[model samples]
Target: MKEERELQDVLVQLSSLAPGPADAPKPAGQALAVIKRQVKQEKRAGCQPWQRFWQNPNRRWATAVLSLLILFTVAFSFPAVRAAASDFLGLFRVQKFAAISVSSEQLALLERVAEEGVSPGELTIVNAPGALIPVNSLAAAARETGLEQVLSPAALGEPDEIDVVEGGDGRLIIDAAGARRIIELAGADPTLFPEKLDGKRVEVVIFSGVQQSWDDGTVLLQTTMPLVEYPGNLDPVPLGEAMLQMLGMNRNEAARLARTIDWTSTLLLPIPRNVATFNEITINGSSGLALASLDGQYGAVMWQQNDVLYLLTGSGDTVELQRIANSVR
Candidate 1:
């Protein structure tokens, strides 16, 4: 009930804060079409706002953080699937996976913020980083992505289709003032925001990758280590704690969790306890995270090996998922 009350209050605040029309840059035509079509489908389905929130195929923590960024920039500006963090050098790669528990109420509140507080036109896509281009063969995919070692599941045999995703650099100039205001409105501690973080820019580099799909609804994704460059003066710990608090976590809990994570090299995966089961598993010799739907119908295994992050998802149990992952070569 507390979260619901907060959601209503946030909705009221958002309505008042909605910006007037402006000439914000938009996504390219093809991307725009896809967005519009998806919106239409959602409207037709009459799905609840929270249900629609979970509908995203790429609902990782990185996506959640990007949504938060969009929410903060709704009046001024404006995202990825893979979760990654930077090293001391400011270049990010996913070296480990951490599972963070999120309650259903928290997810609902976050969805309400996104659906009621932000609109598409409010976000200006400054750079369209990359596109998924179909490739005729594995060798072609390797050539396009410049990946010396392209992996496939030996258990699954040949994939029906392969696509090479182009990667590029994109920058986001933070509107810290706006973000602070939003955090305050959400009943979080505004003082947690760092003053020096204002006007700072975060640069994101998407590394080229490959996606292979089979007719049976299996997907295998491999990408080079992606990078996120935070300003040298910025300490991501407080920023992360603030974001977590805004998501309804208590200050002490949020701080503890934030400090435990190495924001630069760990991918935080938010797991809804009511919907899925998560476990830390060993895949071959590498540590991995295994996730399965509560119903046991679908599962995924994500691991980083040899500087390449790999994700395998399919309609299989965790054991089967692990078997397929181990067969990757």
Candidate 2:
């Protein structure tokens, strides 16, 4: 009876395991692929949508692979765009750093000079930094068209009776004209003017920024940048007698005397062919061409020769020397 029971159970299980009815179509061979994919996805922590795949047999995982490949291609090909973005960021950062570095050094120099007392006849920039400023920087080509040369005070229409004082150490009188004009001895010698000068604005009448007509204009062409304290250095450095001399550069002493205002030139004077001399050496650097001098001590005028001045340093002092040279017609 027990054997008969066992056989009956086996037959029932076999019947249950039989394929479904033929009318209900079974899944195709691709169904096997879905089964494999589900197992793979499950291992990769993805949803195993086995039921959804059955509902839609056409849905293939190849589509997902294709989409991923397309994204990778786009990212790999755009090198220039990435490079340009990198360059933009780098340039901005470098520029900012460079500016800070340059300014820091500049400020330090100004501070040091400020703490130290300024001496006479010694040139230094108060607000402007000598370190930041180049000697040649004094002049730049005037962007305005037609600015040609330095015009002398005489060229202007009227002559204001300026404070013309005779220098104590020399024979010539320093002729100072313009706003609040006053000419006094600059140094202890009583031959120069003012103890400390702060000439911020002085309108110029003469223009000679160039050595020749071709040499465009430059600031400090003839006028020298003055020392912070006037007549500070007793041992003045002698500036060469070039075009600057005509503008009244008295070497080292009283460089402020060569003071020039904001002047522009529309005309040009020809370089002279003759020269005047003192001793055996030519006096000023202009060589007498468009340059001449008066031996203020002796009251004699020197002429230009070979583009140089003659009778270099005469008996008169710098103030007198400048006064006489400038007084030339």
Kindly list the per-residue Cα lDDT of model 2 for residues 1-329, writing each as its tens digit: 99999999999989887777865545676778888887786677654343332233122221121111111111111122211111111111010000001123322432343233322111221221111111221123221112232222221222221111111110111121210111111111222322222332111111111111111111011111111111223222211111122222244422442233111110112111122122211223332211222322221223332221122122334344445445332
Choose the strongest candidate by TM-score.
Answer: 1
**Residue 71 displacement in candidate 1 (angstroms):** 12
Model 1, stretches more than 4 Å misplaced? 1-91, 115-130
Give the Å error, residue 83, model 2. 57
TM-scores, all candidates, are 0.70, 0.14
Question: Candidate 1's residue-wise lDDT over 1-329, tens digit each?
Answer: 99999999999989976665674446589778998999899889986533442564533332333222222212212211011111112335668877766688876665554444422111233444436688899999999898887999999999997978666665555555555555565556767766665666666666788888787767787888666666786676776676667556899998998898886676666677776788999887899888787777677788889888887887778799899999998
How much lDDT does each candidate structure score?
0.65, 0.23
Q: Each prediction's Cα RMSD?
A: 17.3, 39.4
Question: Candidate 2, 276: how far from true, in Å?
Answer: 11
Window of ten residues with lowest summed lDDT in model 1? 79-88
